[model samples]
Target chain A: MSIQIIKQGMADSIQDNGRYGYQHLGINPNGVMDPIAATAANLLVGNDLNDAVLEMHFPASVILFKQQSLIAICGADLLAMINDVFVPVNTPIIIEKNCVLHFKKPLSGARTYLAVKGGFDLQPWLGSYSTNTKAVAGGFEGRNLKKHDEIRFRAAVQKYDAVLNGKDCEILQWKASVKNFYAAGNILRITTGSEYDWLNEDAKKLLLSSSFTISNQSDRMGYRMKGDNLAIENKQQLISTAVTKGTLQLLPDGQFIILMADHQTTGGYPKIAHVISADIPTLAQLNAGEKIQFNIIGQQEAEGILFDQQQQLQQLQNACSFPLLKFKQQYAIN
Target chain B: MKSPLPYHILPLGDHALTIELGNSIDASVNQNCIAVFHQLKQAGLAFVKDIIPAYASVTVVYDVTAIRKEKPSAYLFMKEKLEILLAGMDLDQPVSHRKIEIPVCYDLSLGIDLQEMSQEKNMSIEEIIQMHTNKSYRVFMIGFLPGFAYMGSVDEKIITARRIQPRTNVAAGSVGIAGEQTGIYPLDSPGGWNIIGQTPLKLFDAKRENPVLLEAGDMVSFTAIDINEFHIIKGSI
Candidate 1:
């Protein structure tokens, strides 16, 4: 029920819900920025919400355990393989002990998450298992996994006779499709910033309607974007304060600064619009030069969408037919 | 455009509001930002999660779902609320702010830009030190890096621009000047600020409950200290 690193691939690291409560201390909350994909894979394997998983940047390779276990891969259409054969994403696959699981470089996007049945058991620091490479704290020695790193799992697994006995290879019905939630290069929804009045009506219209490209100067800290020039009522210095993920910092150079998962705690740029919280995951998948437009939606609508997303996740949890796992033990609550 | 002080009240995800304090750069507006920002911090709204104040504006992170349940028109409601907040902003008001006294050593060893700045300002090393420590500066805002406090207007005589080439790492608590602004480096990081002196007081501590000691609208004063006091404070921390 465990795996070890033989070849660490590119940039594989340990990630969970990210380290919170430390942002005030100048630490970035580094974690799996794509919650939907990570959580979906976790739920499929019956793991806790905050369980640590292996986050592979682009692609990676691993050696399987001595015991058989369930595993799921989610996010990014990175060409993946189990041993030498191609493996599909979003479905639970059982791998025999001592098998090699390898993933190829991203055919399209970056970041692929791999979750195991019993979850990866690594000690957390400051209440989180997420890694911050810049701060050199938490997760895999405050760094990414390297070759010859021995990884281990904590809990013993009580095997569930794979449900859907009628099903054969790749139980597509048992999983939910998160790919449907996104449309490549679509307009991201935005809400007006406090500085909108500073911009003329034409500039506001441009901000709402024009297309913006993610600039080359980007990283986990922020996405420097090139788009319509937003005119401020006046130009001057900005004092610093707490800026979080999804924060849009309008720089003096007339470019938009969209804060990301690993952004600094504070900023001086005037934010013109905030990338809606629900849309942040969408932003996470974006690469440099990918163009996107803004679609303004009401705050209530945004919240309703978030609430609905959470509700859907809860629904998946409740509808899980655990009792049906073993017909003989079906009626037993324990 | 009018007395209402036109600006935008934008949304930041489910828990933030980006509030533009004024249309442009004005010292009066910056002071207003400090004032209203302090008031809102005291008011404490449930929808609001965090408020970020910048040079000429402020951003308020809030949960919009909590703010509006009825699905009201965002354009009308947000604009109206923004106007009311700005209209009510009164300058002749008082609010409590935190005060921090920093101990500095302006010795030549740690300050890389000292000699050049001294020559430019046409003053001796001691004259520059006295001029910098003479005034109590306000923390206008915090940005760039963690614990980095952007402060202002130190006698104009010693005012200087950023270094032509940024240093790879500026020691923590190092006090510097960049283009008429004085600030303290909260963490050791690569910076372009003109190095003038170094402070022993910790600007940021991850182990502490409140990581950053300084906030917007707070007052800071530099008090020169001997190496003995510097060593004591360092050991105590």
Candidate 2:
């Protein structure tokens, strides 16, 4: 009936697409870091894209399932296992009652997502299930998942009669291809920002030519970068303005930070660039000390990539629902 | 009717676009930004998710999937729509401005930095309170925290810089001034502003029908209140 967290993770919380339309009131949209992965995980489990999912970081929480259920993990490959047996990512898996789910070690990527079949049974705050830890609203007591916290699933998954074997977990046949979304290399595509002209010619050149290391001070708020000191022509007291996720703001001390999912609604720093919306999933998977380079692409190209990604997600959602409907009709006709 | 101000549309990202009217925080520039905000919201564009108005800019967040169905590019479609909306529009038209009177208690107990600001500005606490309550301010932006409305143009004589070291936790309803701008702390947060007063009224109530008390482009004026009145009003809410 419920999944109890036996071991605590660094920062595991329930998240969905995001809480939107509240940025004007200074309320940020705190959602999943990797939308591609989160959406893929939800689609694999035949849940709505906006259904609540557990976003877990490395050293993720250990959970004990008290009922048979369907789930899928995506994003970072944290070496997930069920009862000490390895389970693949981006594939729907059926877990038997009283099974334990845990992660082995930090393999690749910074965060991962786990989606349940019918989603979590909880009241949403301000029209979203995404947890806003700063505002202390929405999702599992408005905080990170810790030890001994029990989260109830909306409905128990009907026992899969096709695979009625003595096994702790049953991995399905079909899997989703999420590799194209996370492109090769650390080169992130970006477009010029409002204050891109503030940087001198050499500083502008340095931005594209050099690779910056993601500093250890980075967090969900933003990723501070360390690289060549890019100097501006002058320091002007700019008026504070609306900023969004993926904004690359230049600090006064010459470093820059890529604002992430939990960034402030407004900022005063000069915005030098913004990572393309399509590539935010790739950027979200990067960990501290990882070196990343920026490449400025045209705005049209950025929009094209984002549009294509949405289309691909829709196609995946359509493809996954067919088999899920057939399986439900055959076994659970209630 | 006066023509609209010259502005440039810049892409914040693939999903959003920012309209920069000017560089400074002039009233006209801010008004123009607010005008665009109202017009876009009234248009009822299904693709548009949200619109934010700052000092001299307005950002429109849109869904690329929906935009792609209608037009090839979201930026190009939105920019053209905005350009057309601004062209036929008259900037001289009066915008909807709600003048709200806020009750603030300037007692030294709640006004943590009143004594320090009084000495630094070479004025008495009473004079400081009078100067703060005398003039009205415009809500240029609501940011930094939920319901945190950034009001501007504090009395020149009482203009003070932020604290050298910011306090880790400034209580909610604390009114503070930093440079030429003054704002209320809707939530207890780390801030460097010089606190001069506290309002018993909740700046933000998530359970309330309207979560935020103030919005961008509203007119705000403060009235001095005694501690007894502050407690009375605080208890009623």
Best-fitting candidate, scored by DockQ: 2
Interface RMSD of each: 4.6, 1.0
| Residue-level lDDT tens digits of model 1 in B1-237 | 235555566554556555666654345667777776766666664455455676666766544544445445333354466567677766655566688788887877766678998898889988888988898887777666655777776887887878888999888878899877898887778889988878777887655666677876778888987667777877898
Assess each model's interface with DockQ, reporting 2 decimals per model: 0.25, 0.74
Query: Candidate 2: where is the Cα deviation over 4 Å?
Result: A161-164, A329-334
Give the per-residue lDDT digits (tens) of candidate 2, residues B103-203.
99999999999999988878999999999999899999899888999998898998899999999999999999999999999888999999999999999
Report the number of backbone clashes for model 2. Answer: 0
Candidate 1 lDDT tens digits, A42-148? 87666786788777765475655555566788877687776676777777666656667777667755567888877777777777888766555567776888887
Interface RMSD of 2: 1.0
Q: What would the per-residue lDDT of candidate 2 be over residues A1-334, giving only the tens digit for each residue?
A: 7899999999999998888888888888888999999999999888889899999998899999888888899999999999979998989898888999999988999999999888899888788888878777778888899999999989755675455477889888788888988867999999998889999999999999999999999888899999999899968878888888899999999899999998999899998899998889999999999999989999889889888889988988899888877766766622
